[model samples]
Target: MSKKVYLVGAGPGDIELLTLKGMKLLNRADVVLYDALVNPEIFQFCKDDVIKVNVGKRKDHHLKKQEEINELIVEYAQKHETVVRLKGGTPFVFGRGYEEVRFIVKAGFEPVVVSGVSSTTSVLESFMIPSIDREFSDAYRTITGHDMKSFSEIVTQYHSRENLVIMMGIHNLKQIVFTLLEKGYPSTLPIAILSKGTCKDAQQVVSTLGEIEQKDSLFFEQMKQLTPAIIFVGQTLNATQELIAK
Candidate 1:
């Protein structure tokens, strides 16, 4: 009998933020596969017998491809009793959790989703930044800053006065800025990029699309090899100043 694949969200940097249901699965999972950004403390709950694998896809490098990972999910589940695919932030948020789910399902496996706290909330919460508020934003969206097509898709989908959250966007910051600006998101639309979100030494750069590079020298250095971060755009950026001071 084939076991199930559980895609669990490890939450934003903090192990305590993980959901009880997700943590329970981790403890019992036969194969506990995780990404690089996940907090190592979460693994303390798992038994010594559990198998842990690290396969984070960084810029121009990947331990395994989508097809390979899909195969691993099916392969592991068939042998092991349970398989847990742990990822930082929401598994679905730029983490390719959906792709894995699709692949495993196609391979005759049912993937269960356990939602946990995502960086869209915790990262901003750490800095006391709110993603959405009644007076500040009508709505908010989470998007990726990966490729041109992804960035274009975001601009096409979101073009109103709403809060926008971008994940894994450091690499394409310039393109993101140019695209959003061209789409009429306002030159001074107020943007905040949270680096190493929800972790120690976390840095928050608050600037507009045009001023992001100019405002910070580290921005260029960070663009080399930055960790997961959340980018906020719109009035939501301005509204967070008061809360951050508290």
Candidate 2:
């Protein structure tokens, strides 16, 4: 029998957001490797005897290295008829699903990708924020806040009509805010941090580049607890305010 692995997206920390196909695969999976951002409640779909492994990674902690995760997927595929690699959000959207797929294919196993709803858009929508609105924004840019150099290179300047959706940015919120300021982004530009999006305890912190830059270290420290958050900035945020006023 040919070995196969399913790369499934568990969605943005919401159990109901999981795709039907993903849920079906989880129900039949003999082994599952899930990420940190994935809701633990999602595992309820799996069989009672399923083998579940936590291969999640946080800011400074990793349960399993990428290499180990890759090898484990292949190893499990050899013994289990159904092995599922459950990830947060879509497999390819910053989930490192492509790398895992490549490794699995090299090991002679077939890899199947099941796309999930990405937090990039859904998180903003959850807070009544539109990523792209004709009245405010014409386009949106999604980027990672993990690397300062890459971030600076991409966000050369700010456009009022363009919205920015930043992932994994809570850690470097201070620096990110300063970078935007240095890059000619207006200090008064509206920005919002949507944390633990789609989860029950989800919260939103709204501010501006200047205000966030001036926030005390204590504020940033507290923000560290809110991982997997998105830093959204653009004029489109005003639209939400307008709707609320009416």
Candidate 3:
């Protein structure tokens, strides 16, 4: 039997946001390996006897290492007719999906990619914040906040016409804010931390770089509880506020 693997994107947090093709594949999956941020309700579409594995990671804590996950994908693909690797947001967007694809291809199996909605932009839109507005920003940059070194290197300076959408940045919020300040981002530059976007309990914290810098330890402590959050910085946020106010 020919071995084949499907890498599916589960969208941000809303189960409804899942694409039609993704949902159809999930319904027929014989085995599924899902991530931490994927909506649990999505599994409802799968068959009752489907094998489901939780290979999720959170804040430096990994349930299964990357190498282990790669091995499992190949192992399951060899046995199952339909193998699905479900990931939160899009697979390639900070999901380490390309690495998995590389390993699967190396194992001589066909790897199919099914694109889904990414939280980097959808989360911002959920809060009425455009990733890029014609009047405010002409472009947007998406970066991961998990690595401070890469972040510092890429975000050396601030651009008023560009927006920054940072994922997995809740834990390093303070450092990210300080780095922006050091990189010449204005102290009053508008920023927002969007959490659990598209879900019923979604929350947002709107503030400025200077204000966030002055936030007390208690504020940060509270922020830690809001994991799986996205940090947005740019003038587009101000534009969102102005439109909402009027």
lDDT (0 to 1) per candidate = 0.79, 0.91, 0.92
Model 1 misplaced regions, further than 4 Å: 156-160, 213-218, 223-225, 244-246
Task: Tell how far residue 194 is off in model 1, in angstroms.
Answer: 0.4
Per-structure clash totals for the candidates: 0, 0, 0
**Per-residue lDDT for 28-109 in model 3, tens only?**
9999999988889999999999999999988778999999999999999888899999999999988899999999999999
In TM-score terms, candidate 1 sits at 0.87
**What TM-score does each of the candidates earn?**
0.87, 0.98, 0.97
What lDDT tens digits, residue by residue, belong to model 2 across residues 14-131? 8999999999999999999999888999989999999999999988999999999999999999888999999999999987899999999999988999999998888888889999
Tell me the lDDT of model 2 at 206. 87
Q: Scored by Cα lDDT, where does model 3 land?
A: 0.92
The local lDDT score (0 to 100) that residue 75 gets in candidate 1 is 84
Q: Model 3: how far is 52 from its true place, Å?
A: 0.6
**How displaced is residue 33 in candidate 3, in Å?**
0.5
lDDT of candidate 1 at residue 57, scale 0 to 100: 71
